[model samples]
Target chain A: MKVTGAVKTGQRPRGIETSKDGKFVYVAVGDDDTIEIIDAATLQVAGKLPSGEDPEQFAIDSGDKYLYVANENSALLTIIDLATRQKVGQVAVGIEPEGVAISPDARIVVCTSETTSMAHFIDVEGRKVVGNLLLGARPRSAAFKADGSELWVTSEVGGGLSIVDPAARKTKQVVKFAIPGLRGEEIQPVGINLTHDGKLGFVHLGPANRVAVVDGISHEVLKYLLVGQRVWHGAFTPDEKYLLVANGASNDISVIDVAAQKVIKSIQVGEMPWGIAIAPTRDR
Target chain B: MRLGIVVLCVAVGWCGVSFGEPSQQLKIGYMWMKPSKIRVSLLDVPADNDGLAGAQLAIDDNATTGQFLNLGFDLVDREVSKGEDPTEAVKELADEGVGMIVTSLDAERLLAVASAAMAHGQLILNAVAIDERLRAEDCRGNVIHVAPSRTMLSDGLTQYLTWKNWKRWLLVVGSHDNDKLFADALRRSAAKFGAKIVDEREFKDTGGARRTDSGIVEVQRQMPLLTQGAPEHDVVVAADESEVFAGYLPFRTFVPRPVVGSAGLVPGTWNAAFDQWGAVQLQNRFVIKFHRPMSTLDMQVWTAVRMVGEASVRTGSADVAKLVDYIKSPEFSVAAFKGQKLTLRDWDMQLRQPILLFDGRNTVSVSPQHGYLHQYSSLDTLGTDRPSSKCKLN
Candidate 1:
């Protein structure tokens, strides 16, 4: 079955978030600062709710009942009720919020802004920016460990993944990628992935077209993998035996055998598959 | 409890995985279409090194401002044999310190090659594959394409068709299966371009011989009857990829309508008769390479390789990641075959390139006229759009 459905809000919709039960997909339409909801089964667009100003990215709260969208131009985070797809509250963040991540408490949100080069730690309950810590240049994507200990943020301009400790509101480690080969410049990461075991972390190195697999604890580059032209996202199969990589440049998706660390087969799909989220979480 | 603690520790501290610092190598590898020994037809007909011999070409032409300083313009080539494992080859290239790879293969091989590249932080460059699926559903971070997508090419053809007001077509297909597939693509293109297929005809493969006994008389007798009265049509599009009777079409048509498809205005990456702006230089270089003319395959590969050289020079850093970024960004454009600079699409990794609408003798008009509108660019005007698109890259 195709995981297909899109909700066009005001304009320029970029990112999406799915409810835990897989019933709805919340689309972040940046220009209008609106979150549109769609029914996953019927591919029907349902309702539209207010996001903050110029929302860029959003994340799901731990309970899966609240959605937090990071609004860039307005420097705020809009919290919404999952069931109603309605805005419940908004918190002031640092300037130019780009990525959002919900804390383990389900009552706090962490946002990264490009202009300020810092992450604003917010208390969800009070709708306030509780803390601010500087990061790198143009932080774009963010992810959290399964257990929610540390948050990973990718700095597109800085060409690295910045690890932020949520509890302490501090920067942990910065993992950078290689500069471009033929096209010069640093490789800016767009997406982040972690093995089911959570021992391995992979960063989607854009234009670099590789995945930086790092050892989470030691912060070492375990391997740099060439996936495809503009490699974007990857997801593990239910058994965790295969890792499927979306090769943006070539119009193919590679099925990687995890144990062998080799590509078994490449299935051709529709044009340019971008972001991915694997359902029914599996274990190692 | 101890085992759980160890697992937690491993997960918590897994970030310490590095192969030391990177060396300055503009590392690039090749992922060819055919896995075994193969041949690619060139528009320059038998050019060497894809027809760059006479051109003032430099492997390090892209090198600029003291970058790729460790190893300038490192291009490693590996022929992809059908049975040979592409991933293993990618790993081998990585071992040789190649940071990026370029391929002229289908979407299937592109992704396989990409996985291998990812295993070693190597990037893959898709130079020839034009399947739209790769751009939409299979877009990869480590892999970026440098070739015009099939959609782009089709769209190019459709625009000219639309402009020509070739409102009606008699789509004729050869006996070969691939011919039918090409016809299918034409059908899609026709619908997209607002053209109508009055009727579809299939020419069967009889034998090597065309019933030669009294055949000339019979051909004169039947040729007119076969075509003259085909409903209502403005063009007879033949998909005779197998070198069938479509070649005898144009004048032989009963109705005397224009013939297109493979026999008429063909859409392709490059054509030998083309001598646009930089084409003459490219053609000359290719001729010098093989003592003959350039072929479509030769020209495409040559263009793909040259693109790497150009991006390297422009980016001023030969780092594999940086080079890929430059190519992926809208900022990086290459002056290629269709008399314009092309870039990658934001929605799809498909290269937004100009398609040469050729008639085998001379160049026709390039599809993306200046005024075409698209969110990305007029180049996107070639293939399926978001509305008619079936691809959902999730």
Candidate 2:
């Protein structure tokens, strides 16, 4: 319901993720090309780890042993060894890699390139690309279902969400967004997240200023929740009771109550707040 | 690491299976006139690849989307020297099956190429020429103008000035033909927007070098004399598109009035400092790719090529007629980081976009200024409307 605290990081901070144990939060500082480590308990930046050039988005593996970062300018995935806080290796993907995601089982990593329009599949252990699935233009972010059966990637310019079958390594369905009065170009899908039960999905329509709620099974858009301007990314709280979306233009985060499916509060953040990551409460 | 190796092996095994044949190729042509002896300001010189660089970036962007739809896009760039005919280049590109050509030529040269390629049914996107006649009496059926016309620029400036309550203007125009044309547009815009041009003057070219070691001292002395004795006006409107003396009027004006037009707060397609409506991402990408800030000329060409790519993807075909039809349809719109979709006017084929009022450093405002509304789109207020269009596209 409120912004408990805020921590200053390097310029253009984008992707954020909490460690598996929920003790630390990793934020990708894009312009600085480093991931700032925050002590979740204190909400203070405690350390920094080297990432690839212009790291925009990143994902932590299931075991939290490694972090995969999508470097927008470098076109490579920088794999960081979390324990040692060092980059172990890098895998060449596509041009302007902006979105990175890991499977629920932590076996595969998906990196979506904005300029190349390709979703490259990387083997976690081999640290090399296994295969690639061509996606829509300007793909921004990706999320895996809780069960790991499907992967959803949001394409900003293409204005559609591509649902891929992880096993088949191919796109199965593309759910395009079109509002009654809004043009197709305005409905840019950027960040996507699915509920832990895989029953509900939320897609941040960049510039459209709305988050689309879709039924995970039928892929039907159930509702369009209006939010602040230029909404870029979203995250579910540890309790899964609310969704917090970062609006770049509005410089605030819209908190959506899960049960009521409406915006409950607008939490003011730093200038151009892009990505969001939620940490579990201390008791959890 | 062991699981990664096993998965990689299996993926390599699956990669051997082939898919369907590659998509059809969509070839586009970029035709432009080589840099000519145009008046250049010592302080603000033009980039050599101003229009071409933008076209190339858009081609790269289009190819990214094309790759996913089983469509391939190729750009054939042709730059002809001064006094060289561009018709040959257009014919050659048409012969090579290029259905769309983005051009950065003057009004006459563009007309020549358009006429030459008309038989081939090629669609020509005008990216540079801002001559109002091109969108008026000289409009062609196959020519879709991506650059804003002189009228549009003037209208944009007038709207902002009117909104600011600066209702009176001192209009100064250069002797060049393009300058006169722009001045005419300003006059029309003033009449339509309820502003009065208190005084109008023409500054003849008088034939002299623009940039010299000692030109600034002379300019500082002469600018005030040239602007002196004008009636009471809120702003000085300069129509010096030729870059002759307008840049000198900013700080050297007699009455300390703000200048607007080709200098001061100018209306343009894009500005490097513009970061609104998610334009920072685009500006960053352009800077990364070109290692330079994008100019207005580059943005015009980029929009043209992207329109072609959008049409190709939407129609699901590379056929020339189909692409042209789609672009002319109301459903066709291209997002050029302008916070809205830009579409072509059905009557004149001129692109409808909000003009950014930019000073050298930052965006002052975007015009169609807040209250001006049209029945169709607010953008229509910036240029010729359908009822008043002189274009008779056949």
lDDT, candidate 1, B97-206, per-residue tens:
77766676767777888766666776666766766567666767666666665556656776787787877888888888657656777788888778898988887867
Cα lDDT tens digits, model 2, B137-245, are: 9999999999998889899989999999998999999999888899999999999999999999887888765667888788888788888999999999999988888
Best by TM-score: 2
Which regions in candidate 2 have their CA more than 4 angstroms from the true location? A116-137, A162-187, A281-284, B1-26, B37-40, B57-74, B162-167, B191-196, B212-214, B272-293, B306-335, B339-342, B366-381, B386-388
Please list, in the order the candidates appear, how each scores on TM-score for chain B only: 0.76, 0.93
Using DockQ as the measure, the top candidate is: 2
What's the lDDT of the predicted structure labeled candidate 2?
0.83
Model 1: CAPRI class: incorrect
- Per-candidate TM-score against the hidden true structure: 0.48, 0.86
A135-213 per-residue lDDT for model 1 (tens digits): 5545667777767777888876556688888788778888766543422232657677666556777777765767777
Question: Cα lDDT for residue B93, model 2?
Answer: 93
Candidate topping lDDT: 2
